[model samples]
Each structure stands twice: as C-alpha cells, then as structure tokens.
Target: MKVLLASPRGFCAGVNMAIDSLEIALKAFGPPLYVYHEIVHNKYVVTHFREKGVEFVDHLEEVPHGATLLFSAHGVSPEVREAARERNLTAIDATCPLVTKVHLEAIKYARQGYTIFLIGHEGHDEVVGTMGEAPEAIVLVETPEDVAGLTVADETKLAYLTQTTLSVDDANRIISRLKERFPQIASPPKDDICYATQNRQEAVALLCSEANLVLVLGSQNSSNSQRLAELARERGVAAHLIDGAGDIEAQWLDGVETVLVTAGASAPEVVVEECLDFLRDHYGAEVEVRTTREEHVSFPLPKELRAVSVE
Candidate 1:
C-alpha cells in the first residue's frame, strides 16, 4: 500500500491561537480553568486538556463567578459575552478573527434593519454563536431547498453571511440560490469561509483523485472535518472520518491500493504521525508527502494573556 499525506492539513491559525491561549492560561491561572466549549473540536485535544485539569463547560452556570473563562475558537454572541460579564468571569476570547468578522457583519446588518440569512449547519457551535448575534434579524439557511421557502419582510433590505468553517462548494451553491431568489441580497466584501478550510478541502480533492481510500482525522462534531470526508465521498472516492488510527477498521483496508491521509484544522499532527506509523507497521505502506498549497497564516494570543507568561 502507498500512503499519500496531505499538506496544509491540521492545526490552522485559529486553532493554533486557541490552543496556545489555553496553554498560556494554564500556566498563568493554573488548572481548573474553564472554557466555554471544547477548545477545538478534536477529541484528543479536549481529552488531553481535560486530563490536565481544564474543565470544559457548556453553560455559564457551570463556571463559578469571577473564575477565568476562555471562549472557544468558534466565536460567541454578544449575549454569551454579556452573561460572562454579568458573572464577573474574566473572559478571554479565543474566537478566530475570521469568525469574528461574520459576527460583526451580522451586527451591522441587524443595526441597518436588514434581514440576514446565515448559511450554516443548525446546532453547530459557531452557527449557534453567530445566530445569537441577531436572532430576530438572522434566519438560518441550511440548504438550497431551505432558500425556496424563505420569506422576508422586505427583499430590498436583505444580506447574507456564512459560517467560517463551511464547505466552500456547498456555501457557493447555497449563495447562488440566494442570489437567484433575492437579487438584491448583499454579500460580504469577501466570502466568510476561512482560508484554512478552503485550502484543506482543495488539498483533499486533489489527492483523492488517485487514492482508493481517504482517511480524515477529526472528531465527529467538527464541522470542517465532516466536510472533508463528505467531499471525498461526493467525488466518488471512498472515505472515512475517524478520530484517530484506532477507529480505522481492518476491513477498510481489504482492497485498498493507495490511501490518502489528512487531518482537520483542529487535529494535531502527532495523531497523523501515529496513523502513519500504524499503516507502515501493518501494511508496510510506502509514504509520499504532497503539497497542494502552502499556508503561512498565524494568529497571536489574546491580549489579556500576553502578560501571563507562556512557555
């Protein structure tokens, strides 16, 4: 078997910032630190942090008053921020700047009395956070079919924004439908899908062309990770989304000739390495590293934590 490892895969800039912020926080504030959600959507990352004494919580009620709390990379709505403030919790926002851009756009559209359409999956942490920005003005639009039934008070006063981690092709398809239905719908200066998401997907699509099987390393709840596997299956290639190498089934390798391995933005490269080791020891897989694109993007830690010494 031959292994094709993907480039521009795993731990994008936003994930880097979020993870680093937590590490710095841990050093300065110590364990028992509370995070609003899973720091990033990787089971290993969350479990690693959990074992280190970081407490991941879903609600403000789960955190004690005045405790230091860091928001997840998937940005939070003003309401969540306000609630944190109400409890006097020292909140350090680790929201990706790209996601923050969408929230700001939502606020701007809502303030302008424009009905906003957000293209994202329902119940996703980022979607939920973005929706909380202007629940009254923002309507969640999941599919092109959903666009058909959408009603607006005034089509003239309409705008559309998207979740940063959405599949690029999917978002484009939905946007096309929105434009056809509401010609006047305003769009952001640039598409909201983050560079890392688009780059990883592009890499996967390129490598998927030659591989008999594609393996995506990511947690189930990860939006970007799910899209990678779905994109492969959509391309007529067999793919599986697994948290790590342990999830790989022996039957999956039955007739596989070439395999493509990649990781989601939140996944760590160590997990990717472990997977490669497994493939080599068991199948004697020959490995080739390929690059579809080069990524140099980076993000700085939250300002409040700058003073907190980071190792």
Candidate 2:
C-alpha cells in the first residue's frame, strides 16, 4: 500500500499561535488554567491540555472569579469579552486573526446599515461568535439555497462575510449566488476564507485525484476537517474523518491500495504522525508527501503571554 501525505496540512499559523499561547499561559500561570473553548478543535490537543490542568468551559460563568481565561482560536463575540471583564477575569484573547477580521467586518457592515449575510454553518463556534458581533444585522446562510430565502431590509445595503473555515469552492458558489441576487452587494477587501483553509483544501483535492481513499485526521466537529472529507467525497473518492489512527477502521482499507492522508488546520502534526505510523505498521505502506504550496505564516503570541519572562 502507498500512503500519500498532503503538505500544508495540520497546524496553520492561527492554530500554532493559539496552541503556543495556551502552553505559554499554562507555563506562566501553572495548573487550573481555564480556556473558553477547545483551543483548537482536535481531540488530542484538548486532551493533552486537559491532562496538564487546562479546563475547557463553554460559558464564562463556569470560570472561577479572577481566574485567567483564554479564548479559543474561534474568536468570541464582544459579549463574551464583556462577560470576562464583568467577572474580573484575566482574559487572554487567543482568537485567530482571520476570524477576528470577519468579526470586524460584520461590525463595520452592521454600523453602516448593511444587512450582513454570514456564510457558515449555524452552530459552528466561529459562526456563533461572528453572529454575536451584530446579531440583529447578520443572517446565517449555510448553502447557496439558503441565499434565496434570505430577507434583507434593502438589497442595495447588503454585505457578505464568511466563516474562515468554510470550503473555498463552496463559499465561491454561495458568493456567486449572492451576486446573482444582489448585484450591488458589498464584500470584504479580500476573501474571508483564510489562506490556510484554502491551501489545505486545494492540497486535498489534488491528492484525492491520485488516491482512491483519503483519510482526514481531524475531529468531527472541526469545520475545516469536515470540509476536507466532504470535498474528497464530492469528487467520488472515499474519505473518512478520524481523530487519530485508533478511529481508523479496517474496512476503509479494503480494496484501497493508495490512501491520501491529510489533516485539518487545528490538528497537530503529532496526531498525523500516529496515523502514518499505524499505516506503516499495519499495511507496510510506503509514504510520499505531496506538496501543494509552501506556507510560512506565523502569528505572535498574545501580549500578556509575551510579557512573561522565561524562568
């Protein structure tokens, strides 16, 4: 069996920064560090941090008063920030810059009286946070079909923003439909889908063309990871999204001589290594890494973490 690994997979700049921030926070603050949500949507990452005394909470009220609270990479709304402040919590914002950009755009469009159309899944953490930015102004649309049912106060004052983790092709299709309906709709200065998401999806699409089955190493709730699997399946290739090698089923390998292995942006390379090792040990698979693009993007650690001196 041959295993083709997708390059530009696994951790992106945002995930790297968020993970680093948490580690730095833990090192500086010690045990009982509280994170607003999973720093990144990988089971292994959350589990590792939890073992190291990190507590992931869905609500700000869950955190102890005056405790250090780190926001997840999926940026939170202003209301969350206010809640942290209300409790006197030492809040560290670990939101990915790209997601923050979308939030800012949502706020801007709302202030300008534009009815914002947020292109994303309804319950995604990122989408939830973004929608909270301007709840009254932003409307969630999941697909191109959802675009038709949208009710905006004024067609001329329509603007669109997207979840960073959405499929590039899917977003483009939705954007095309939005344009067809509202020709004068405003858009962000650049595409809202982050470069990392676009790069990883493009790599997976390319890898799927040569491989019969694609194994995506990512948590089920991970939006980008789910998109990767969907993209491959849409291309008529068998794709499975697994958290790690343990989730891999023997049945998935049947009649599959060449398997493409890739990971979501939030997934760590360590998880991917485990999957590769399993494939090597079980199937004697020869691995080849296929590179689609070179990425050197990096975001700096949060200011509070940077202020801490190394011991």
Candidate 3:
C-alpha cells in the first residue's frame, strides 16, 4: 500500500493560535481555567486539555463567578460576551481573525439595514457565534434548498456571509442559487471561507484525483474535516473521516491501493503521525507528502493574558 498525504493538512494558523493561547493561559493563570467551548472542535485536543485541568462549558451559567474564561477559536456571540460580563468573569477572546472578519461584516450589513443570510450548519459553534452578532437581522441557510425557500422582505437589501469552514463546491452551488433568486443581493468583499479551509480542501481534491481512498483525521463535529471527506465522495472516490487511528477499520482498506491521508485544521499533527504509523505497521505502506500550498500565518495571544505571569 502507498499513502499519499495532503499538504496543508493539520493545524491551521487559527487552530495553532487558539490551542497555544490556552496552553499559555494555563501556564500564566494556572488551572481551573474555563473555556466557552471546545477550543478547536477536536476531541483529542479537548481531552488533553481536560486532563490538564481545563473546563469546557456550553453555557455561561456553568462558569463560576470572577473566574478566567477563554472563548473558543469558533468565536462567540455578543450575548455570550454580555453574559460573561454579567458573571464578572475575566474573558479572553481566542476567535480566529478570519472568523472575526465575518462577524464584523455581519454587524456592518445589519447597520446598513441589510437582511443577512448566513450560510452555515445550524448548530455549528461558528454559525451560532456569527448569528449572535446580529441575531435579529440574520437568517441561517444550510443548503441550496434552504436558499430556494428563503423569504425576505426586500431581496435587493440582502447580503450573504458564510461560515469559515464549509464545503467549497457546496457553498458555491448555494451562492449560485442565491444569485439567481436575488440578483441584487450583496456578498462579502471576498468569500468568507478562510485561506486555511480553502487550502486543505484544495489539497484533498488534488489527492482525490490519484488516490482510491481518502482518510480525513478530525473529530466528527469538525466542519472542515467533514467537508474534506464529502469532497472526495462528491468526486466519486471513497473517503472516511476519522478522529484517530483507533477509528480506522481494516475492512475499509481491503482492495484499497493508494490512500490519501489528511487532517482538519483543528487536528493535532500527532494524530496524523499516529495514523501514518498505524498504516505502515499494518499494511507495509509507503508514505509520501503531497504539497498543494505553503501556509505562513500566525495570531497573537489575547491582550489580557499577554502580561500575566506564570507560577
């Protein structure tokens, strides 16, 4: 067996920043730290943090008063921020800059009296966070079918923003439908999908062209990771989205020759290496890294934690 690894596979800049911020905060502020959500949507990462004394909560009410809290990379709604303030929690935002850009755009469009149509999964952390920016003015649409059934007062005064991690081709198809229905609808100055998401998908698509089977390493809840597997399926190749090597089934590899290995932005590189090692040990697989793009992006730690001293 031969393994073809996708370039730009694991740990995008935003994920790196978010995870690093937590590690730094833990060192600086000490344990009992609270996070608004899974910092990057990977169970492995979350489990590691949990073992290290990090607390992940879905609601602000679960957090204790006057404690230090960190927002996830997926971002949070204004309501969440207000709730944190009400609880007197010292909060630090670890939202990716790209996701923050979309929130700002939503706020801007809402201020301009545009009814915003946000394209994203209904319950995704990022979608929920973005919707919180202007909940009264934003309507969520998850598919082209959703676009067809959408009802707005004035189509001309409409604008669209998308979740950062979405299927590239699927998003394009929905956008096309929206354009046909509302020609005057406005879009973001650039597509809201971030560079990391695009590059990972592109790398997987490139892998699909040659590999018979593709393996995407990420948590089930990871949007970009799911999109990689879906993209391969859309291209008529077999693909599986797995959290780690433990999730891989030997039956799926039967008759499979060239396997494409990739990871989501939030997945740690160790997971990829472990999966590779598993494949090699079991199947005598030869490995090669495929390069589609080179990424050099980084984000700084939150201001409040920058000067905090570690014990």
Candidate 4:
C-alpha cells in the first residue's frame, strides 16, 4: 500500500502560537493554569495539556477571581472578555490573528451603517465570536440557500464576511449567490478564508485523485478537518475523518491501495505520525508527501508573556 501525505497539513501558525502560549504560561505560572476552552479543537492536544494541570473551563464564572485565564485560539466574544474582567481574571488572548481579521471586518462594516452577513456555521466558536462583534447588525448565513432568503433593510448598504476555516468551495458558492441576489452587496477587499485552510483543502483535493481512500486526521469538531474530508467525499472518493489512528477501522482499508493522509490546521503532528505508523505496521505501507504549497506563517507569543519580570 502507498500513503500519499498532503503538505501544509497539521498545525497552523495560530494553533502553534496558542499551544506555545499555554506551554509558556505553564512554565511561568506552574500548575493549575486555566484555559477558557480547548486551546485548540484536538482532543489529544487538550488532554495532553490537562495532564500538565491546565484547567479548561467553558464558562468565565467557573474560573475563580484573580486566576490567569487564557482564551482559546478560536477567539471569544467581547462579552466573554468583559466577563473575564468582571471576575478580576488576568486574561490572555490566544485568538488566531486570521480570526481577529473577520471580527475587525464585522465591526468596520457595522460602523459604516452596513448590515453584515457573516458566512459561517451558526454555533462555531469562531463564528460566534465574530458575530458578537456586531450582533445587532450581523446576520449568519450557513449555506448558499441561506443567502437566497436573506433580506436587509438597505440592500445597497450590505456587506459580507466569512470565518477563516470554512470550506473554500462552499464559501465561494455562497459568495456567488450573495452577489447574484444583491448586485450591490460589498465584500471584504480580500477573502476571509485563511491561507492555511485554503492550501490544506487544495492539497487534499489534489491528493484524493490518486488515492483510493483519504484519511483526514483531525478532531471531530474541527471545522477545517471536517471540511477536508467533505471535500474529498464530494469528489466521489472514500474519505474518513478520524481524530487519530485508534479510530481507524480495518474494514475501511479493504480494497484500498493508496491512502491520502492529511490533518487539520489545529491537529497535532503526532496524531498524523501515529496514523502513518499504524498503516505501515498493518499494511506495510510506503509513504510519500504530495506538496501543494509551502507555508511559513508564524505568530508571536502574547505580549503579556513577553514582559520582563521584575527582579
């Protein structure tokens, strides 16, 4: 069996920064470091951190006063930040810069008296956070169908923004529908889909052509990872979205000779390695990495973490 691995897979710059921030915080503050959510969506990553005494909380009130709270890379609503402040918590934002870009666009369009249409899943952490920026003026659209029924008080004064980790093809289809319906609708100067997501999906689409089955390594709740699997399946290829090797089933590999392996931006590399190792042991697979694009993006640690300590 041959394994075709996709390039630009696994952790993205934002996930790297968020994970690194947690490690740095742990080093500086010791055990019992609290995180607002799973620093990223990967269960392995969160479980690893939990073993190191990192506490993950869903509600700000669950966090004690005066505790150091780190926001997840998925970003949070302004209300969440305010709640942190209300509890006297020292908050560190690990939200990805790409996600922050969407928030800024929502605010900008809302400030300009334009009703904003946010293209994203309704309940996603990133979508929720971006919508919170201008809740009064923003409307959530999950699919192209949603765009068709969309109505605004001022059609000419409408704008659209998108979540960073959405399916590129789906987002474009939705955007095209929006444009067709409202010829005067405005969009961001640049697309909101992040480079990491675009490149990874493009790579998987390319890899699926030659592979009999595509194994996407990502958490079930991970948007980008789920999109990768969906993209492959859309091409009539057999695809599976597994968190790690343990989830892989022997029956799924029957008649499958070439397998394409890829991971989500928030997924850890170790999970990919484990999956590859499992295939190699079970099927004596030979591996090859198919390059679609090279990535060099890097985000700096939080400013608070960089401050020099007083002697």
Off by over 4 Å in 2: 309-311
> In model 2, what is the error at residue 273, expressed in angstroms?
0.9
Model 3 ranges off by over 4 Å: 309-311
Q: Could you tell me how far off, in angstroms, the CA of residue 253 lies in candidate 1 after the best superposition? A: 0.6
Which candidate number has the best lDDT?
Answer: 1
TM-score of each: 0.98, 0.98, 0.97, 0.98
Clashing pairs in 4: none
Tell how far residue 3 is off in model 4, in angstroms: 0.5
Give the lDDT of residue 254 in candidate 3. Answer: 95
Instruction: Give Cα-based local distance difference scores for all models.
Output: 0.94, 0.93, 0.93, 0.91
For model 1, the local distance difference test gives 0.94
lDDT score for residue 220 of model 2: 91
Candidate 1 residue-wise lDDT, 176-264, digit = tens: 99999999999998889999999999999888999999999999999999999999999999999998899999999998999999999
What is the per-residue lDDT of model 2 for residues 9-102, given as tens digits with 9 covering 90 to 100?
Answer: 9999999999999998888889799998889999999999999999999988899899999999999988999999999999998899899889
Deviation of model 3 at 265, angstroms: 0.8
**How good is model 4 by TM-score?**
0.98
lDDT of 4 by residue, 50-115 (tens): 999999999887888999999999999999999999999988888999888888888889899999
lDDT of 2 at 63: 94
lDDT of 3 by residue, 146-209 (tens): 9878999987799999999998898899999999999999999998998999999999887797
